[model samples]
Target: MENWFSLLQKNVLNQQSWTTREQLRLAIVYWIEARYHRRRRQRRLGKLTPIEFETIMKDPACLAA
Candidate 1:
């Protein structure tokens, strides 16, 4: 799948005219919440927030394995 920025540029922007910085920021927020934030798993919430969930399963001795 494409990264966050690419997805937003393709989907939300869709050549729409964003006349102000605020519009760009709003689009980014929508992308993050829809694509990233909601998809993540959080450990505190039992494997819910990818960051927290990933942290729960990671091994400190190895960065990536």
Candidate 2:
């Protein structure tokens, strides 16, 4: 959790100047959901992103699906 926050701070927060509280909240959520969660591969998921792992588990017929 510390690493995740550190990455968020360095990559997202440090790179921008948010004007409002809502904007900052949305930016954090976007970084976590759209970028980090979808891009970071996990060893527990066989070196796949959470999205990839879910797709594989949902449809065993084709990995490309």
Candidate 3:
């Protein structure tokens, strides 16, 4: 949780200026959704996105272990 906050601080808080509270909220949501969540690779999927993992696993010839 601390690291996540640090990331937000470095990437969002320290980088830009907002004219309104609503704008700031929207910017944070955009960064988290578009840049952070979608792009971040997880170890559990062997660095693949969830969609990529699902596509590979969807192959009919692949056996589940």
C-alpha RMSD by candidate, in order? 9.1, 3.6, 4.5
TM-score each candidate: 0.43, 0.67, 0.64
lDDT of 3 by residue, 1-65 (tens): 99899999998988878899998899899999888877677789999877677788888546653
What tens-digit string does per-residue lDDT give for candidate 1 at 31-60? Answer: 788776767665667766775555656766
Q: By the TM-score metric, which is better: model 1 or model 3?
A: 3
Query: Which digits, one per residue and each the tens of the lDDT, describe model 2 over residues 2-62?
Result: 9988999998899979999999999999888899989899999999999988887888766
lDDT of 1 at 63: 61
Each model's lDDT:
0.72, 0.89, 0.84
Which regions of candidate 1 deviate over 4 angstroms?
A: 40-65
Model 3: residues >4 Å from true position, as ranges? 42-47, 54-65
Residue ranges of candidate 2 with Cα displaced over 4 Å: 42-47, 54-65
Clashing pairs in model 2? Answer: none
